[model samples]
Target: MHRSLCLAALLSLAASSALASGFPVTVRSCDRDVTFEAAPKRAVSQDINLTEMMLALDLTGQMAGYSGISGWYKMDDELKARLGDLPELAPQQPTKEVLLGADADFLFAGWNYGMKVGGEVTPDTLEPFGIKVYALTESCIHIMKKDKSSMEDMYTDIVNLGRIFGVEEKALALVDGYKAEIAKAIAAVPADAPVPKVFVYDSGEDKPFTAGRYAMPTALIEAAGGKNIMDDVETSWTTVGWEGVIERNPDVVVIVDYGDVTAEQKADFMRKNPAFKDIPAVKNNRFVVLPYAQATPGPRNVEAVKTLAGAFHPTVN
Candidate 1:
C-alpha cells in the first residue's frame, strides 16, 4: 500500500511538471504565427476589453501596466476595484514608444487598438524586442480571414490566453461560466416569439453608423431575441444613410454608448430628428443602451446580451 501511494504521488508530480514545461505555445494572429516561450511575467494590455480580460482571468499580477480607454465609462465595481491599482501607461491609445517602454514581455491588444495603420509599432516591429503580441480574435479577421465574428471567437481568445499563461484550467472554467450564462440568456426567449427588428446606433448622425455582421453586437442582438436590421452589412462597423435606417424601421434601437456623446444624447438626437421621428423605435422610445466595451468582444459580452434581451423581450420576466 505504501508503494502504491508513492507511485500515485510520483504520477501527480510528473503531471504537474509536464504542465509547467508545456511552453512554446503558438497561436495564429493576423495571418502570422506568434509563439511564446513561457508564461509572460510582465504583460501590457491595451483597450478596456483586453485589460478587463486579464483581470477576469485573475492575471492582474502578471500585468506590468495598461494603456487604453479604461476610464471611458463606468465598469463593474469588482472590475474597477481589481484594476484600481495597476499603473497607467497611457490614458488612451499609446504609441509604440510608450508600449515598448513599459518593458513588458507580452502585449494584449486587438487590431487598430494597439497596432494602428502606418504606426511605429506592430507585431513585426516588436518581434525583435522578444515581445509577443496577440491580436484579439475578433479584430484579427480584419487583417486575415473572413470568419464572421461571434462569441466563439471570444471563447477561443480566452482559451488561447489561458494556454499562453499556463492557466488552462482557469481559462476553461471562465469559458464554461460564460457559456452557461449565454445559454441561460438564450433559453429565456420563447421559440414562438417573433424576433424583434433591431437597429444599432454606434455614432454619426448624417451617416448613422451601425454594427455589421462582423461585430459582436450583431451576435448579442441575435441572442437577445432580436435581429439586427443591418446584419446584411459584411463589414464590422459601417455607415448607412438615414434613408436606409428609415426604410427598415427597427422595433428597437440599441445605442452603443461610448466616445464623447452619452447614450442619452444619441437617443435624444434620434428623437429630435425630423427624419427619424417617424421610425418605429424613435416613435415608441424603445431605446436600449449598451456600453462600447460590451459591444466589443470581451468578458462583459454576457452582460451585454442579458441587458439587450431584457429590452427586446420585456415580457420574459
Candidate 2:
C-alpha cells in the first residue's frame, strides 16, 4: 500500500509538470501567471478599440466575435466588408452564454469594466474551460502605481498587444510613424507662444460633462498648443454647472462628437446655452468638433492632435 501511494504521487507530479511545460505564458494587465496552448486560433474581442488594434496588426482573421461596432466608433468600410460574417458579441457586457457558446480560444478586451459590471467573465471564470484572457494595458487602472495616465501608456498597450499577437514588428512600425508625426507637429509650434486655454466639452445636455486633468483630453490639449481649462480639476470627468463654464470663459471649446451626436445638435447646444454663449469661444466662434475616438488616447490620438493644431493655427497653413 505504501509503494502504491508513492507511485500515485509521482504520477501526479509528472502530469502537472507536463501541463506546465505544454502551456504558453501570457502576461496581461492584472497579473502574469497566465498560460495558454500555442497561439489562439479563435479570438473574441470585447471592445472596438482592441478589435481595431488587432486589425491593425493583421490578426483580424483570428477574431471569432467582437462588441461595440455599431455605436461610438464604427469599424471602417474595409473591415466591415471583411468581417461582415462574424457574430456580434453584444454591446458593452455580453452574456456568459454568448461568450462561452462562441467557443473562442482566447478573449481580448480594452475595458475590464465590461466584465466587472455585467459580463460575468473573468480570468478564473474562463480558466476552467481552457480559455485565456488579456486586458489592454491602456485600460489597466493599476500599473507602475500611477493615479493618472498618459499617451505613452497607449503606445505601450499597442506594443504589448502586438507582442501577444506575434506582430511586434508591425506594431513598432506603426508606433514609430505616429510618434514621428506627433513630434513634427509639436516642433512646428513655437515654444514661446502662450498655450491657448481650451475646454473639452465631452457632452453637453442638461449638465455638461467635461474632461478633467486625469485623462487623454488633458494630454490632447497640451499636445495641441493649448492648456486644458479643467487641468486643475483632478478627476477624469466632471459634470459642471453653466456658471462654471462662465467663470472659466475658455478661448477654444472643443466639442467631443461621439458620432451619436450630430455637429448641428452640438452647434445648437452651444448657441442656445444661456451661460456658454457669452464665453469667448462661443462669442468668437472658435469651437472645434473632434470625434470621440480621436479624442481618446489610442493609436489614432496623435492624428487628433494634428487636427487640433491645424484648427488652432490655420495661419501656419
Candidate 3:
C-alpha cells in the first residue's frame, strides 16, 4: 500500500509538471511583443468577435467583462448559452476607468475598435497597469505598418489566445476544424464553374461603402471561388462612386446585413435606383446577404466562405 501511494503521488506530480510546460508563451502583435507568463485568471473582451473566440475556447469563466457593438447580429444559440449575462463594461469601447476597475490582466480587442492609436486606453496606458493587449491581426497593418491581412491572421490570433489561456490543444483543434470545414466547402465548388465578379455592399447609399483588398471579405470571396471587383483598391474599406459599380457591372452583389438597414431594403434600394438598374446583378437579382459578424475576421470566416460558395455555385452539392 505504501508503494502504491508513492507511485500515485509521483504520477500526480508528473501531470502537474506537464501542464506547467505550456506557460511563458510569447506572441507578437503589430510591432510589439506581448508575453504571457501564465494563464490569465481575469480577462476582458473588447469586441464581440473576441467574445465569441473566448467562448469557442471555453474560457468564458476567465472573462471578467465584455464590451463592443452588440445587436448587429444575433449570436449562435450555443454561443449565447455559453455567454449568459457576462457584465458589459461599455456599450462600445470601454473607457480607461472601466478597464481599470475590471482588474483584468488581459484584453482582446481590435485596433481601432478597442484601443485606438493615441487614444485614451492604448497598450502603453494598459501596460503600466500590468495588462497585455492583443490586437486583432487584420487591423494590425492599418495601425502598425504590419503586413497585409490574410485568413491566417485570424487563425494565428485564435491560436495565440489559446496559448495565452493555456488552451493550446483546444486552439489547434479549432484551427484544424475551421481549415477542414473551409477545404470541404471549397472542394464542393465545381472546377469549371465561372467565377462570379462580386461587389461587397457595406452600406452608405450616397457614396457607397465597400470592402477592398485588405478586408477579410475579399479573402472570403476568393475562397468562395468568386472575384471581388473592388479588390483593386489598396485599403480595407473604402467609398467608391456608383459609376465604379456600373463600370465593373459585377455578376453578384454581396449585401452586408448589419444594424438598422435590412438586406431586403438594400436589395430594394438597388432595384429602384436607376444607376444600379443596368448592373447585371441588379437585373437578375443575384444578391447574397452575409451577416456582419461572419464577414469580419474571426471564427465565422469559414462559415462565410461556405455561405459564399453556396451562393456562387448552385451546382455544388
Per-residue lDDT of 1-317 in model 3, one digit per residue for the tens?
A: 69999999998987687567776778887778888877787799876677878878988788887887564444456656667877877777888888889888888887765777788887889899998888887777566554454678789889988888888899999999999999999988889999999999989889888988877888899999999999888777779998888899999999988778888999899999988888999999999998877888888888899989998998885
> Per model, how many backbone clashes are there?
0, 0, 0
lDDT of 2: 0.70
User: Positional deviation of 88 in candidate 1, in angstroms?
Assistant: 1.5
Per-residue alpha-carbon lDDT of candidate 1 for residues 1-317, written as tens digits (9 for 90 to 100): 69999999998897777656786678777677778777898899888888878887888888888887645553456766778788878777777677678887888887767776456767777788877889887776567666776788889888888988888789999999999998998898888888889999999877888888788888888877889998888777778887888899899999988887889999999999898888889899999998877988889999998998888888775
> Candidate 3 regions off by >4 Å?
1-19, 71-79, 146-148
- Which candidate's lDDT is highest? 3
TM, every model? 0.90, 0.80, 0.90
- What is the TM-score (0 to 1) of candidate 3? 0.90
Order candidates by TM-score, high to low: 1, 3, 2
Error of 3 at 315 (Å): 0.9
Ranking by lDDT: 3, 1, 2
Q: Residue 149's C-alpha lDDT in candidate 2? A: 45
Residue pairs with clashing backbones, model 1? none
- The local distance difference test score of model 3 is 0.83
Give lDDT for model 1.
Answer: 0.83
Collision pairs in model 3:
none
Instruction: Output the better candidate (1/2) by lDDT.
Output: 1
